[model samples]
Target chain A: MIQRLLLLLFLIVFAVSETADAAVKTIVLDGSTTVGPVAKSFAIYFTKKYGVRVTVSESGSGNGAKSLINSSCTIATMSRAMKEAEIAAARKKGVNPVAHVIAFDGLAMVIHPANPVRSLSISQIRSIYQGTIRNWKEVGGANARIVVIQRESNSGTQESFKELVTGKRMRITGNSETQSSNGAVKNRVSTTLSSIGFLSLGFVDSSVKVIAVNGVVPNEKTVKNGAYKVTRPLYLYTNGQPSGLVKQFIDLPNTPEGKGMITELGLVSR
Target chain B: MNIGTRKILDRSFTAVGIGSIVVMALALMIVVVPIVYNGIGAVFFTGTVEHRKMLHAEFKRGDSQNLDSEVASTDRYRAKVYDMLTGFEAELETMAPEKKTEYTAKYAQVQSALRALLGPLPGDPEPMLTRFKYGQTRWEKAEEKLHDLLYESKWDNSNSSVMSKEFFVSRAISFEGTSLARLFPYVKENLENMLHPEFTFYWGFITDSSVDSHFFGGIWPEIQGTFFLAIGAMLFAFPLGVVAAVYFTEYAKPGFLNSMLRSANSTLAGVPSIVFGMFGLAFFINTMKVSESKSVIAGALTLAIMILPTIIRAAEEAILAVPKTYREASLSLGSSKWNTIATVILPAALPGILTGGVISLGRAAGETAPIIFTAAVSVGSAIGLADVFSSPTPALSWNIYNLASEHEAAAQLRHVQYGMVLALVTIVLLLNLSAIVLRARISKKLKC
Candidate 1:
């Protein structure tokens, strides 16, 4: 009888504590490897200002949508807008995903900083990714083979590149090496003399030459004004109309302070 | 020194030894407990009805009749939750536009939380992704989802001196007097009926292919790849290592050439693993154009080089450890020097040589760096024996690093990562265990 009473007491305490755990505020932001850097910075600043514990995960845009639809995350930070299928899926689950544009990013074609080739036409770039243009000399560079570095299949940046540059129905060569993230792609391109890869404009550094496409170099001005072809808007998706902390977080990129932070990270803010 | 002083010193020394052993054991426990606990979760946990549904739909492994009955029972309770949602939606439509918008936002939160806890509602359209087709497969996640339904979490930033604290407001209080208010309590009360979680032992985790980058599935490809790479390395290194060891022990005179060769072996052993990857890439792939790109053959070759020196050293020691009387006896019985060395000396050293080979195989299997450039790929289906010369495959070592670090949903798949680690540890330990048993049996036979 005493053991039973003690067990009941222990269970009561456990139940009470478990319910109390719900009181802690946490904002979960997931999705988009390309938008990861900006989301991380925003989370840090937001947590500092609002005292909200913000968790950010960089799984890719599709996963971000999945998280939002699944109600796992409060905000899904995506480098690309939700596809029709994703929006339908969210609506089906009663999650009215509302897109908030945060920043603009350009897919910059990068090569070894020492490579002499200045620019490539859209068709030439397509051919290179398509495996038709295998050597650097074909694109007016050295005699080395162009080691194509690409992001893995889960990357939103890779999806965007395929849509804008590679086009559907054309496959990237099997020999093209696959890396997991923008940083990895940049690392490969920087280290390999004959390698060519694409990264978000913000990830471009002096170690790699951010080559021009169709006579236009990717930058804040070029990407923002639509002069650069391979540009996309970064987004943060919230289910229905965001309120409280979620609203404040979604509106961060519009604030003067947030714009400065975004620009510092090499992203173009409207 | 006095007798008591000497005794005190001796006691302290014994205490020190015991303390050190305790510390080592404690360290080992600290490292192993979490791994074993989480690793067990990969195969054994409170699996919900959705987990069963996923198994039935994806792998076709569960009983249809039992699953249907369970679904029917859960659905009987779930109907009321859906009724409350539609009623709330209707109430919102009749309200003022501003109020309607406000309620719509709040209503969506409750709906999503319900969807997460249970599967998609009756009126909801079919979901494309398998992840959405089911609710929380694990009971812990289900409870977390239920909390989201009960409370609306908000951050309290009133204090400026410290980090903000989060506070949860009861959803029932937020929607007081509304049709949705009654839904929260009713659903919470009947959550067990909604999701029948049971302890499941899913042995398929070792055999099944992963679903959605290891959100669910097994580590079969990684296990097979480790086996292939390790065996392939042994195929190349064992005979060559043993021959080199034999030559060094019996034929080579102790002179300048021998010392230089020994120094070179040590130098090769000292090279960092990542440098071996780079060298493999440069020499094997780029220079020799081995199979055009990364392959099992290339990886095995790189691993053989990495482990060759160790094998050679071990074999040399084993050959030297053989008693001189055995070789002398064989020679006195009119046996040629070469025949005596092969039949008697090698037989005596066989177990020792095998122990080295087994250890080398484990090293080759666990190694990630040398294979990264030469053979390992982050993601690929398991290849057959014929494809080893041309195809790069997912290995346990590389996949563990890839899944733990680079996977988009790495944190969500902690169970898979731990399972992979446990699988690898088991494989390596088993190899070492077999080596021990083999050596023991050989020693027993020799004595007889």
Candidate 2:
């Protein structure tokens, strides 16, 4: 009887404390590293404005979609559209996920600043990466072996590159050097004299020269106007029409604050 | 020194050692604690549900807002929803308070219909306002309806299969189930999505099985390719390693030629693995026109050379460890020098030779840099394995490296890669342990 009374008192105190504190909302955002900065910025502003918490994680687009499918995150940020198979999988689970354009990104083909070549035609760029053109000399550059750098499979950047450059066809060169992230690819290209790699325009800077593909450089105008052919939409895919914190966070990325952040991050405004 | 002084010194030294272990353990905790603590803290953190509800309210706030699109669907949705809500409100004007329930239900249906219709608008603002006007009236009516149905709607809160089950259960959950019962928590997961995920293009190099255009399915062909290369290495190294060890330990005299051979063999062991790879490429692949400069045979031969020292050392130690008395006994029986050494010394050292072969095999399987220069790409399904005399093959270590470094997004599978490492380690461990166990069994049988 004494123990039971103590438990009752404790329960009462717990209920009182629970009622005293306001609830918090947590939204998990996961997907493309390309979309990560914008998502993170939105999450930060949303959290501050509404007192709701948001978590952001960056994997590649494929993994991000998996995170949504696997129920690991509230939203999947992708630089590509959801494939038919993914939509079917979600529908199978009775989840009719909705997508909203978060922003746009121009995939950048970059090289060391020291590289002599300033521009490459789409055909030339494809040939370099596809191993058909092994040496830079063929493309009006010094006679040096072009060290081709590539991204790992899970990267959204790789998907965009394949879609835009290869038209979803052609194999990558056998001897290509692989880097894990945009920074790593940039670093490798910067340090290696004859190395070339692709990155999202969001990651472009003075360290590496963003080469013009067929005289088209990666810019907000280029990407937005579709003049930069190697561009993909950054997307926020939700399990369903977001209801609750997720919806609020999703809306936040399309707001003035979110757009400004995307612009600052070098991502093209949607 | 007295015995007690010696004992005190030993005790203090032991205490120092124990203290150092504790200090190291504490340092390890410093590294691990924050990770574990944050994981626990995030899981147990509360106050999420109310925030979730509030966010939902935000979505509905502008639900009655205008959509900018002039599309046919938006126009139809806007007009249909406005008509239903306007008709409901007009109907409500004539309704008595006793008939408020019917008016409310009709009002809710109008809002749901409006929300459903305008949801697809691409942020167009004109039709959205009309949709919103209908939604607000619908929202109030729906809230009332929700309050009435709240208890009945989520009555079966314990159904694990329902994602909304958590919404109905009391927030303060205390019971912890055994491992078997823990399966209920994951019931809502779309496991098929995990089992059949849409992979991107990076997986194409490994396995192209996704039926999708992205990946090539699996690295199974690469794995098989690596196996072929490692097997080729073993084939060339095993017999040669054993023969050299047999000659050195069993038959070679303690003279100039023997010592010269021994010194040269020992010196060969000092050559770097990469040097061997280069040599193999130069001598075998390039000069011989053995398919290409980066073929499996060249890689295998290069690895065989790299592992030669290991094989030789193991075989030599095994053959040398065989007692001279056994050779003498066989000689006393008038057996030929070759026969006596073969029949007596070789049989006794079989276990040791196998131990050496296992070590050599492990090194061949795991070496990456050597194969990188000598064989095909670090991880390629296009294996040069068909013509054993010419083709190049990739290796497992190369597979891990390529998957980790070059395969976009394969870096995200750190756990899977780590698990693969664990598997590789287990293979080596089992092989070594099996050799030890075999030696022990053989010795026991010989003793009996």
Output the number of the lDDT-best candidate. 1
Give the TM-score of chain A, superposed on the true chain A, for all candidates in the order listed.
Answer: 0.89, 0.88
Residue-by-residue lDDT tens digits, candidate 2, A93-161 = 666768898788888999876666778998898888889999877887766789999988878788788
Model 1 lDDT on a 0 to 1 scale: 0.80
lDDT of 1 by residue, B294-405 (tens): 6788888889888999899889999999999998999999999889879999889988998998898889989999987677654444455656676666788987886765
Q: Using TM-score as the measure, which candidate wins?
A: 1
Cα deviation of A83 in candidate 1 (Å)? 29
**Cα shift from native, residue B161, model 1 (Å):** 6.0
As a TM-score, model 2 comes out at 0.43
Q: Give residue B37's lDDT in candidate 2 (0 to 100).
A: 50
TM-score of chain B of each: 0.93, 0.55
Tens digits of per-residue lDDT, candidate 2, B281-369, equal 56665466554225667778888888887788889998889889999999999999999878988888877887778667767777776
**What residue runs in model 2 are displaced by over 4 Å at the alpha carbon?**
A1-270, B8-218, B378-387, B412-416
